[model samples]
Target: MYDWTQDKAVRVLTRLASEGLQTDQIVDDIISHVDDFRYEAQMPTFYFLSGLTGNKKVASKVASLLQR
Candidate 1:
């Protein structure tokens, strides 16, 4: 029942990232929805991932996730 087509989820995540409020839970949530995103919307999700640099582990996970 998750509607990935909506931009609301990505926008909230991006806002959290832009504010330097990213957390492991947030990153995990993003990853959980990776496959749900449309092509155009993926870019903003990538932007959200890019903001999660405070944790090296999360950064590495994001790197590998993007490679897939």
Candidate 2:
């Protein structure tokens, strides 16, 4: 499930970016989850990468998913 979690994290991060989430805030959030055994803490960081593409609503939805 590592790859899946990593992919999910990347997808969410892309969504967050489209939603206009600040880069620093996103970075901080991701970093904070480094030790998290839940929700693949790195997902937010993956989304923050420059090349990832996603929509604002999608990002928000991803964010909601992580919150769950």
Candidate 3:
């Protein structure tokens, strides 16, 4: 059987972004209401949406954009 919960979460986040929520807000919202996310894919989805602090290159890019 195919799982739909994870795909549902991704769609929710995508729709939220398309509706004009900023990236930081998206992460914050995801964290605050994490219970809405399916447990099976929570960790990976959280990290993918929230990002990698230890990734210097990606961090720098994000920071640079935020600075503008």
Candidate 4:
């Protein structure tokens, strides 16, 4: 079974990095887990990235995805 504690850690770290609310450690975490995150974490990553950098494209993509 998936270990949600670890999974949640990955998500949290990725979000922190995306928000620029972190240092290199969170980025390292994101990079280290990138492969495993392809399925579940992609949307959260996009959400956090959009929130931090105000990327309209990412936001629009998420919006479109939700719209469907």
lDDT agreement with native, every candidate: 0.67, 0.53, 0.54, 0.55
TM-score of structure candidate 4: 0.39
TM agreement with the true structure for every prediction? 0.57, 0.34, 0.39, 0.39
Candidate 4 backbone collisions, by pair: none
Per-residue lDDT over 5-25 for candidate 3, one digit per residue giving the tens place of the 0 to 100 score: 765676577456545666456
- Which residue runs of candidate 2 sit more than 4 Å off their true CA positions? 1-6, 14-21, 38-68
- State the lDDT of candidate 1 residue by residue for 1-68, as single tens digits: 43565567776865675576756667777767766777766666776667655756557766887698
Q: What lDDT would candidate 2 get against the real structure?
A: 0.53
Residue pairs with clashing backbones, model 2: 9-43, 13-47, 14-47, 15-59
Which model scores highest in lDDT? Answer: 1
lDDT: worst 10-residue window of model 3: 49-58
Better structure of 2 and 3 per lDDT = 3
Ranking 3 against 4 by lDDT, winner? 4
Off by over 4 Å in 4: 1-11, 14-22, 50-68
RMSD of each: 3.8, 10.7, 9.2, 5.6
Task: Give stretches of model 3 more than 4 Å off.
Answer: 1-21, 50-68
Error of 4 at 60 (Å): 20
* Span of 10 residues, lowest total lDDT, candidate 4: 49-58
Q: What is residue 51's positional error in candidate 3, in angstroms?
A: 3.1
**Clash statistics: count for each candidate:** 0, 4, 0, 0
